[model samples]
Target: YKLIIHTDTLIGLSFSGVHTWLEMYGCEWDDQTGAADAFDQFGYDGEDFVSLDLKELRWISPVQQGIPTVQKWNNDRAYLESDKNYFSTECIEWLQKYVQYGKSSLKKTVSPQVSLLQKSSSSPVTCHATGFYPSGVTISWQKNGQEHHEDVDLGELLPNEDGTFQKTSTITVTLDEWKKNKFSCVVEHQGKTKTENEIRTNPEGSVPIGIIVGALAAVVLLVIIGVAGYMVYQKKKGFKPVSGSDDGSNSSAHTVPQA
Candidate 1:
């Protein structure tokens, strides 16, 4: 027997008296000729094949077939007919929870909004502080307890492509003045004031004083040795000492006849 199902009504037609078992075995038939060949090989009536309607045949197997296909069809229909408003509500709720507790949040916080450039030295004492920023800023200089304005050089503000600005400031003074002075750069932006100060010192001139003292000591020692040697020579040769005259009152001195 051969059976075929092609409708949503789930009807199956079988030929011959080979029953469903033969139909199961003959399911590999490719066409009408193949079905007739299988029937002949299985000892079924090739000339008198019977037509069967399997629509009322209740499947008695323990395993229920076609479950996965039915479930897929149902899911596709549901997705086609359902509204997306429920999903949008879920997304809004998730965002609210993230904003409330900062959990599952993916936003980047703004940085400290500051950068310091390298201070360049023009003289042994004076230097220029240069940097860039994202907005308008202020720059100033202070020496000791007084504000320094004269001789302070301020560079022109250059606007960056990202709407930020940069500027440089220079101050000139003696190395000694720099050591005694305190220089600061103040920036005012977004209603906030930030200040950076650089105090100068003579690192190169602060060499060891002990070295100079040691050199002087060596020169004094050589001079003392040379003077002592000259005094010893004058005493040994009976020459009058250069300091003062002898009194001639010693016991070793005697009166001598005139020669």
Candidate 2:
């Protein structure tokens, strides 16, 4: 029988003029034999700066700029030894408690809100899913219950201020396709519940409400202009109407004479 033991820690720091923002320490051992197989120190100094491979007794990614820092760290063995001592004595216990709290808190789930919208006839339909926990979520486009890949644009998962993740998937469809069938956006997350939004087809030859209203207004304006023009044309042709009786009595109706 074989068993293995592994421990690692990651720490991040931000300071003025400090390019080294992140660091990690990793060590692995064989449990049954009680012998370590690997111990490593890796860091990022504006990039992957350097790594100490204790198993090989060598350094990896020894950039010219980082060589001096590596040499200085290696020569000051006492400080490195002190760091390891602190991690084993004080950090491990606190890390374990934090891990336990994470596991318990993650058991609670939040459902995502799915929205399906289209910007215009020329644009694709956007499937936006937001406010979900545990970032490992799948958002996809489905056409009539089957997975669709063609003409689909997938967006990156972005973190929100509330610690939740949001993603969007868009699918290009012509006006005919949008009016002929239905499409859906499906979201699958860690929780048992799944959320989806269905976009139903619009009626054939249907236009947006704004466009419809504008067309009607145009027609009404044209009709008004045509009637006004006809009245002006009749007056220009020298057609005259008989005046009404001055008293409040019905007068004989008289038609304008033809020009």
Candidate 3:
């Protein structure tokens, strides 16, 4: 969100005044369902003065002081039609273009690393899941093999510096509750990677309770480093290594070229 600020004025011999107004308008686009929503609103003296209802193509005013302006603006059918058309079609197309341009990063899914943390034996246990993408995940606690919700406190989903997301869920249990029943934190996420220990038994796309994605990241890092190292060597020094995937797509991973 940003502040809406601008100035407009028509200087003529009949009138001389500054036309500074505070107003805001924007649109939201959903790529999954291809739906677009728009809003055009205005404020006056730090109050909700008027807004445009796109569906009705009419202006709405909360305060009585805005009634005259609303009634006058609502009567302009041509202006309303043009406003609706621009926001629904043109604005949405521009936003979709930007989304398409950033599809690789925006749509990429990175698996999370789940860990149970506690400051002391008596402290509440926090189930932390971090370094994930898309920000949609589930974290729950289980007691005696069943779902538990009584003492659970879910944390806010936060962004990481590398464009990933992290979340935490804490469960408070006493010594008696711990000794008598089995307590476990369950985290659910998609796009899980296969691991060596559980590869043979688990079926393809099986969602384990939790798995560290760093092993997979390490392997990818090594592959990228190898490719970058090969490119660093000039053709005169050695053979230039060609890196290509099965679909013939080359990764953008790179390092500083050798001097």
Candidate 4:
């Protein structure tokens, strides 16, 4: 069954006029129950503009601004019938193929490699989790063995080129703060947690030069994203591509063991 809520004033629907957007229609099917669902939704600037009512097999407009186009689409008998047939049959076939193609990789889970990174002495310390499968992980910081939240920055879940995923959480702390308290990074993935002391005092008075220059581009990027948010694409509960993440070529990477 299709889910549609109708009210006179477009109650919860948000509309935007500044940007233009259009979402391709979506279709879903259940293999075991032989059930099917379909939707043709259009959005403009993140606003729900219009959608097709599969139950009535007609186009319905949530807001008044979309009415004119809705009227035109609802009047097109051939277009309506063609859409109905396509969603009921063609879409399901493609969805099934997609399920078969990615099922093995999508169901597999690989443990992540966790590390703490700092571009320079003054840069924010980052806890990085990479080479994990299925794209879900939790990266957090702890001070004195307790959860620490202030001045923490959570990064976007990004894809890697090797079919795994990577993520990072960064924290800004002063040299005095580090000297006064113990700081650690905790990464939880697939029911296991890895906790490691993120800051180390190099008695040699120097860190690998490559480590400082390693991922310089990424460090600059983190500063930009810390100030301005990054773009994220919303994928429905279906198949999507995941390219491997580029874990930089820093030879002195300190990795924590999985528990």
Candidate 5:
């Protein structure tokens, strides 16, 4: 058996077109076997305060165990028939109508797009799943079909701009393990079937995209150098050599001085 209770109060004031939000508080309790296993209260009355730590179940803030101030502010008996009311009775009615409309009109299910990516060859790999609805998801890493918890960093589900949700999980691996072992990212969503994304391992001595580009550049540079050297050699070989004397006999030119 389970029992849960939630209380929320919002205090807002508007003048003409401008509005001011003054105070807000939310409280939750679970009357677990009459012991109240989950009793916590948090709010901001011009200053943030919490009655008890939700996890530790102990007082951590200056505020002690007491009913939230918002409750007293909203109590019907606190307001007089002649006095101006702080809360808008019309707004409360509209809020209830909106809740009913959301329950029946909202689109609730959306499939997620799961992807596996790495920042670099040596960096940790991230498994990102995004564009899902309802925000209930489980992301984990598995090696050889066995789930791994150590070295895995799990992130919380965050809402997207388009009313969807996204989450990411990361795992560190040695370069040897990254290349030799098979690792997969498993994503489980409440609305969609389970999904898996396997890591693509590079073969031994295989060049990456960046390394391949560098090799091509090196080859181009070598080709340019070879072409330049060959041009220089051709120019040297094309030079006309001094021919032997026209008489075909080896001779030297001698100039005589006249008296």
Candidate 6:
């Protein structure tokens, strides 16, 4: 009574018992060598039956009417040999059991996304970048050292409903190539390639230190207004000229003597 049928119900009971055992015993064999001779006439001792257990075997009425069509043609040829090796883990567990029995259909195709941001106004440099399968990305802008892609500006590419896609790019430089020179962000996808760079140097403002402290406080206020106008011109040229008393003394006393 050793009935054991499983190797996926032995390919649908080897095609419904080889078309009813080839119209009652006139066989010829083909469907993969008649399913390897009907799993050696049912008692499959093939060493590997992929976890067998045909409901406690013991079937007869033509192997229980070809065991569920040979276990659905051995799970559709082991899901087409695990989708031709997509790093099969048993073809992803038989496509998660053919999408939990609803008999899956399959769909998924995403690959696109990239990013990079840069700014430099004399040393305060900043550059961030990213890119991965973004279909085909390209960005460029440089100065002080050359290479400027037409005023530079590119952004807009956001799609993710599983289709995959993203974008971001910016360029604004100065302060000596944003401090020094070298500034870049180039990416090209679909063929695989990437690049990112930054080199800084410019920084020193405050109106040039307030125009050198307003020209040294206007030359110390013109040397304190020329020493306060030369001390008010020496106190109006050292005033005082009282000469009336010089001869007055003699005239008054000698009026009656020496005329």
Best by TM-score: 4
TM-score, per-candidate, Cα-based: 0.28, 0.43, 0.42, 0.44, 0.41, 0.21
Best by lDDT: 4
Counting only residues 3 or more apart in sequence or on different chains, how many pairs clash (N, Cα, C under 3 Å) in candidate 4?
A: 7
Cα lDDT of model 2 by residue, 57-155, tens digit: 444555676677666666655655544543343333334444557778787577777777566566677777777777787877777778888999987
Locate the minimum summed-lDDT window of 10 residues in model 2.
250-259
RMSD of 3: 17.2
**Residue-by-residue lDDT tens digits, candidate 5, 1-259:** 1211223444655565433222222222222342222333444554445443434323344554333443343343323221121112222232344455676646577878887766557877778787787788888788878878879998666656565677788899987986787788888887456556565445444433433443455566678789987876555222111123234243221111110
TM-score of 2: 0.43
Question: Candidate 4 residues 1-259, lDDT tens each?
Answer: 2222111121233474345545456577777787998877777556888888987998887889888888887778887887777677655655665676678667798998887777667777778777787778989888998999999999877656555677778899997897799999999988988887755433344543323343454566577676553232222222221222224222121111110
Per-residue CA lDDT of model 6 for 96-176, tens digit only, reads 333444432223223332333222243333322222333345555555446766445665443332323445556655555
After superposing candidate 3, which stretches have Cα over 4 Å from the reference?
A: 1-14, 20-97, 191-259
Candidate ranking (lDDT, best to worst): 4, 3, 2, 5, 1, 6
Worst 10 residues of 4 by lDDT: 250-259
User: By summed lDDT, which 10 consecutive residues of candidate 3 come out lowest?
Assistant: 250-259
lDDT of every model, 2 decimals: 0.37, 0.56, 0.62, 0.66, 0.52, 0.36
| Model 6 misplaced regions, further than 4 Å | 1-51, 54-116, 119-179, 186-190, 194-259
Clashing residue pairs for model 5: none
Which lDDT tens digits does candidate 1 get at residues 1-259? 2222111111234774332211111112223353221111111122222221122211122223433433443344333222122122322232333344543223322122332233334342223222334335566666664677877777655433332344556666665665576755555644565566653444443522322444455566679789997876555223211112235332121111111
Q: Which should have the higher TM-score, number 3 or number 6?
A: 3
Report the lDDT tens digits of candidate 3 across residue range 60-151. 99999889888888777777877777667655655665566687677788887777765555666677788888888888887777888998
Which residue pairs does candidate 4 place in steric collision?
Answer: 160-243, 160-244, 160-245, 161-243, 161-244, 161-245, 162-244
